[model samples]
Target: MSADDSVLLHTEGRAGYLTLNRPRALNALDHTMVRRIDEALTAWEHDPAVATVVLRGAGARGLCAGGDIRAIHRDASAGGGASSRAFWRDEYRLNDRIARYPKPYVALMDGIVMGGGVGLSAHAGVRIVTERSRIAMPETGIGFVPDVGGTFLLARAPGELGTHLALTGAAVGAADALLLGLADHFVPAARLSDLADGLAGAGVPETVARHAATAPGGELAAHREWIDSCYAADTVEEITERLADSGEQAAKEAAETLYTRSPTSLKVTLAALRRARALGSLEHALDQEYRIACAMLTSPDLVEGIRAQIIDKDRDPRWTPDRLAAVTAAEVARHFAPPAGPDLGLGAGGAAARDA
Candidate 1:
């Protein structure tokens, strides 16, 4: 589909609708899609006729899988990092905008919403999930840290649940998402169409109330005791040790999952989550993520991870340092340094320095 067709836009009475339209790719977001969505929001923000905004994806599989990693893989492999950086600049800005949108932004997070998908929906004023919803920020598996204000959201989740999810790249169901504060309401998948239709004439609160139902019991709450205890450690190594000795099957599984991820990414992701907690604002967290994203462009793991997971489909990424012990503090610290170009500057002050 063309750029315009990638995101379908329309209006229904008082509601403006934005639908992610690339079903074949599970509506995986790209630079063009981000720009288009931002432009639509800008137009609707100023239009008095538009009282609310709604977002959804086109296909049955999911709202969005994540960013176009294949594209990033190609760019990083070719030593052309500028294009990917530009995409992140705009994408992060759009994420900040969603968090502060004036109009009631209602996100229909109905299916698999991972990585960039979480960024698009989790920050909205009203986030709705369903039985089909499987939400996560699974970036570490691809040797990347979560961007688009993901660290900000993850850092704020109760206890160390965020750390567990971040390290394991685990996809949670509706109830777990709600417990994590990543989503607001749970609506049955069968009633999502009705909920969308109701928004056309009714206010957001009433429309959502009509369909919202109690979410089924989640898995995380039961594991909170173990998760909080194991992930509370200061270092990933300590965390792993705690998990392995905790005797919880789930904690042990989480440790095994970490062993398969890029060691450098695990270390960086842990640092990012801790730093995001101190940053205390979505804009600041986004700015930090921008720097890390630019740094990843030059990291061999980003390219190799994507190659193994997506391009080559071998599922075996040979990380540069390969071991957690080998990823020095200096190496992890480098990702936090100012990028080569103009900083995203979203958190420098209250205003965005770079134009979106």
Candidate 2:
């Protein structure tokens, strides 16, 4: 499909609606989609007719799976580093724009929301989820650190739960998302269409309250304390050792999951989370992430990870440092280093414009 066909835009009454249209691809974003979204949001920002914005995916499967990474893999194969960088830059700007948007933004995060999906919904003013929603970052599986303001949001999750989630690329259902502060409202899947039809100038809260159901208890509750203790360590080595020593089934499971991911992705992700916690704002975190993303474009394991997991379907990536211990402190440090280009030009006035 053409780039313009990827996003279907519409307006009804006072609400502006966006339907991610590539159901076959799970609406995986490309540079064009990001640019189109930025353009639309910018125009709608000043239009008094648009009092609220509603965003959702078209298919039953997901809001979005992620960036068009297979496309990026193609670019990597052709040595199109500059093209990959451009895509990330535009995507990051779109993310920043959403975070700073003026109108009341509502996201129907009703299905598989990971990577780019999280970037789209996590910053919305009114984030909605349903029983079908399965949210995660899951970038480490592709041999990359989370980006598109993921580092910023994940850092603020309660205790070390964020750390555990990021490293493991584990998918969590809607209730778990609410517990992580990744979602705001829990409306059932059946009522989503009704909610959109009923939205008028300023009635979203009341309408949502009427539809909101009591979400099922989060699975994280069972292992929160264990995750907090084990993932809170200063280093990945320490965290794995602690988990190994604990003998708790959950802790052992977490360590095993960590081992399955690319070691470079894990170590760099840990450093990203650490630095993100100390950063000033989402823009700051995105800048840090932009650097890491640029690094990912150059990593051999990224190509291999996608080859095994997505291309070949073997599910076995030969990461450069195949073992965790081989990923040095300096190697971890390099991913956080400043990029050769300018920082993500997200500007200084966004956070004030949009409420966190």
Candidate 3:
């Protein structure tokens, strides 16, 4: 479909609606989709008739699976990575805009929301999830660090829960998403239409209250004891070691999952999450993510990871440094370095931005 069709936009009573319209591709966002959404937001921001903004996906599968990784793979494989970097530049800026949007921005985060999907919904003013919702920032699995303000959001999650989710790239259910602060309310999938309709005439809080229900119990709380103890380590290597020796089956499984991801990504993701904790603002975290994203475009693991997970479907990525120990501090540190070109500049005057 054309870019305009990819993101269907319209107005309903007091609400302006953005429906991500690529169900067949699970509404994977492209640069055009990002720009279109941004433009719609710009127009609606000053429209007095647009009291609220609602975002949802057209397909049953999810709001958005992520950015067009197939395109990213093609760009990175072609070696220049210019197109991919440009896409991230706009995409990340859109994420920052969503976080600070003036209107009551309500995101219907139903079904599978991962990577860029999380960036789109998690930063909104009001995030809604459902029983079908499966939310995550599964970037490491694709040899990427979580961008789109993921590090900022995940870093603020209680204790080491974010750490566990980041490294393992695990998808969490509605309750877990709520616990992680990724979502604000739970509305059953069947009632999502009712909620959307109600949004047209009523205030967001009232509409959501009428539709929202208690989320199904999540697994993370039960595992928090083991998760906090194990993931609190200083490094991915240490975290894995702790998980391995924790004697809990879940911890053991988490450690095994970490081993499957790219070693360099695992280390860099850890560093990014740690640094995000101190960055203090979404803009600063986004800036850091942009730098890491550009650097990753040149990494062999990014290409290999996309090939294994998306293209070849072999599920076997041959990372440049096969083992976690083989990834050096200097290599991990390089990801945090200032970009050779202009920085994202979202946090231009902030102390974090100055330091970065």
lDDT of 1 by residue, 240-331 (tens): 99999999999899999999999999999999999999997999999999999999998999998999999989999899888899999999
Indicate whether candidate 1 or candidate 2 has the larger TM-score.
Answer: 1
Candidate that would win on TM-score: 1
Task: State candidate 2's TM-score.
Answer: 0.95
- The clash number for model 1 is 0
lDDT of 2 at 154: 88
Per-prediction TM-score: 0.99, 0.95, 0.97
lDDT of 3 by residue, 180-281 (tens): 999999999999999998999999999999999999999999999999999898988999999999999999999899989999999999999999999889
Off by over 4 Å in 1: 352-356
Candidate 2 backbone collisions, by pair: none
Clashing pairs for predicted structure model 3, backbone only: none
TM-score of 1: 0.99
Candidates in order have lDDT scores of 0.93, 0.86, 0.93
**The CA-based lDDT of model 3 is what?**
0.93
* Clash count per candidate: 0, 0, 0
